[model samples]
Structures are given as C-alpha cells and as structure tokens.
Target: MVLCELKQQLDELLALSDGYAYCNQEVGRLACVQGQQEAELTALHTSIEAQNQKLLASTLARVQKEGAIRKGLEQHQQKLVAQDGQAEVLKQQLAASNLARESLSTTVTTALKKLALATSTQAQRVDSVEERLASLVERQRECEVQPPPGWATYLERNAVSLVALAVAVFTLGLNLLG
Candidate 1:
C-alpha cells in the first residue's frame, strides 16, 4: 500500500512539473505580448504628438503668411485647403490608433487575469501535495516504531529479519521504479 501511494505521488509530481513548465511558458508569452503592446502604444502616442505639433506649426505659418502676402492670396488659400485635408487625415489616424490601443489593453488585462489564476491554482496544488507527502512520511515512521496489529510477527526475533529483508526488497523495487 505504501509503495502504491509512493508511486501515485511520484506520478502526481511528474504531472505537476509538466503543468508548471507549461505555465511558465504561457507567462513568458504573455509578458512578451504585453511588452509589444506597450511599445506600439508608446509609438502611436509619439506619432500623434508629432502630428499635432506639425499641424499647429502649419496653422501658425498660414496665419502669418496670409497677412504678409496679398498678391498670391489664391495660392495661399489653396495651400490652406491642402493643410486642412492633411490635418483631417492625421485626426483619423489618431482615432484609429486610440481604438487599437484600447483593444490591446483589454487583451492584456484578460491575459494577466488568466495567468494569475493559473499560478495560484498551481501553488495550491503543490502545497496540497507537500502536505500529503509529509503525512505519509509521519505514518511510515509510526509503522516502523510500532508495527500494526496485522504485523504482530514483528514481535518475534526471526520475524524481524524477515520483515527487514522484505522492506529492503520493497525499497529496492521502488528505487528501480523511480
């Protein structure tokens, strides 16, 4: 019975190790995704800021140049119209970037929640397994010091030798299985 329980615990340990490895891999992947999203969001904000500055400069230039030049008012108006179109285009791009940022933020949040849950669940399982192993070890010690009623032959001197040989063989078999 002890050997079977040991084998079961070993199997559980193996499975837990595999799950731990998989969780680590998923956490790494999520981290990479978050990093990439942050970089992209930062770059988008930079682009938006630069475009706003450019728009402001162009507006100021148009105001100053409009008053200074009268002979080519028609050409100035055409240039103003072109600048207005570019500004509109930049506004649309900024809106799209904001939308993309929101979507990525949601994805990152969900991934973080899932990773946290998986980590906690694995920790709980590990703790439970450790408790079970500790209990088993304590029980083994008790059995060795005072054999159970079913093992009453332990009171005989020759039975001690037989029981010791059996234990040695069991341990050897367990080692081989392990």
Candidate 2:
C-alpha cells in the first residue's frame, strides 16, 4: 500500500509539468502575435501623420490663394467706381457741348435771315436809282434834238457859261450822294 501511494504521487507530478510547458508555449505564441499587431499600428500611425501634414500644407496654400483673389476683386471694384465717375463727367461735357452747338446754330440762322433782308432792300434801292437815271438820259436826248428859237442865239453867245453850268450840276450830284 505505501508503494502504490508513491506511484500515484509521481503520476500527478508528471501531469502538472506537462500542463506548465503547454501554457508557456501558448503565452509565447500570443506575445509574438501582439508584437506583430503593435508593429502594424506603428506603421498606420506614421502614414496618418504624413497625410495630415499634406492636408495642412494644402489648406495653407488655399487660404493664401483666396486672400489674393479677394484683394484683386477689391481693386477691380475700385477701378470700376473710378471709371463710373469719369463716364458721368463725360456725359455732362457732352450735354454742355450740345447746348453750345444749338446756340451757335440759332445765331447763324438769325444772321442769315438779316443778311437776306438787307440784300433785298439794297436791290430795290438800286432799281429805283436806275429808273431815275433812265428818265434823266431821256430828258437830255430830247433837249439835244430840239432847240428853242432864242436858245441858239443864247448858246452861241454863252458856250463857256453852259459848260460851267454842266460842271456845277455834276458837282451837286456828287455832293448829294455824300
């Protein structure tokens, strides 16, 4: 009975030793798997950090471009305002020029009318003077064609006096014109 008890104790000790060895092997396999998972997580973190840096750089560039576009729009708006002011000034000048042109046209029309009226009056005066000259010439021709009975004796005795009278009549005509 004492030998049977010692053999049973030896069997129990061998079974415990086998269980400890199996547990140690399982722990080592789990540790290797954990190490592999940790290495993959580190690689993923590195990729995420690089992507974030790229995104930050892209955002900064976009912001700068937006600021430049806004400044350009503001400058263009200011130029448009200045051009609008110039257009208004040009419109006013055009209006003033139109008014001046109308005034000049009116003045010219009035002057032309007065000139036509004066020309008509001068033509009528010339016609009257010409008719009077015709009548005087007719009278002088009649005088030359017929002489009175006493005229021949008077002309023969006063030829110089007749010449002087003719000169006096011509001088009177010039004085009347003045």
Candidate 3:
C-alpha cells in the first residue's frame, strides 16, 4: 500500500507539470499575436499620417489656384468696365458727328437757295442795261452827221454821258457774275 500511494503522488505531480507547460506555451502564443497586432496598428498610423500630408499639399495648391482665378476675374471685370466707358465715348462722338453733318447739310441748302435768287436778280439787271445801251447807240449814230450848233454840242455831251453809263453797267455785270 505504501508503494502504491507513492506512485500515485508521483503521477499527480507529473500531470500538474504537464498542465503548467501547456499554459506557458499558450501564454507565449498569445504574446506573439498581441505583438503582431501592435505592428499592424503602427503601420496603419504611419499610412494615415502620409495621407494627411498629401491632403494638406493638395488643399494648399487648390487655395492658390483659387486665388489666381479670383485675381484674373477681377482684371477681366476692370477691362470690361474700361471697354464700356470707351463705348460710351464713341457713342457720344458719333452723335456729335451726326449733328455736325446735319448742320452742314442745312448750311449748304441755304447757300444754294440764296445763290439762285442772286443769279436771277443779276439776270434781270443785265437785260435792262442791254436794252438801254442799244437805244443810246442808235441816238449817237444819228447825231454824227448833224450840223454844228449849240444844241449839237449838248447832244455830243449827252452821247459821252451815255457811253460812261454803259461802261459802268458792264463793270457791274462782270462783278455779279464773278
């Protein structure tokens, strides 16, 4: 009986040592799994930080592009305003030119009408002077053969006066024509 008890105790101690070794191996496997999980989490954090940096660079480039676009738009707006002002000035100049053209047309018309009236008056005066000159020439030719007397001298003086009047009339007609 004493030998049997001693064998049983030894078997129990061996079974306990086996249980402890199995528990220690399981603990070591659990520690390795936890280390792998930590490494994966660290890699994920590094990837997230790199993505954030890329996003920041992209955002800064977008902001700069937007600022340039805004400046370009402002410059375009200023050019449009200047063009509009120039257009208004051109419109005013056109209106003034049209008014000047109309005024010149009216002046030309008035001058033409006045010239026509003056031409007609000059024509009537020329006709009347020509008729009077024809009559005086006939009287002077009849007096050329008459005998000398006091009345004949007066008639000769009258012939000289008629010649002077004809010369005056011719000079006035030439002036009116020019």
TM-score of each: 0.38, 0.42, 0.41
Measured on C-alpha atoms, candidate 2 has an lDDT of 0.59
The C-alpha lDDT values of all candidates are: 0.57, 0.59, 0.59
What pairs collide in candidate 1? none
Residue 35 error, candidate 2, Å: 1.3
- TM-score (C-alpha, index-matched) for candidate 2: 0.42
> Candidate 3 lDDT, tens digit per residue, 1-178?
4347546655665665576566556555655655665576567557655755665575567557556655655565566567875555555545665565567556556755755675565556556555655554555444444433344444464566557667878999999998
Ranking by TM-score: 2, 3, 1
RMSD of each: 18.3, 74.0, 73.2
Better of 1 and 3 by lDDT: 3
Please give the lDDT score for candidate 3.
Answer: 0.59
Q: Which pairs clash in the backbone of model 2? A: none
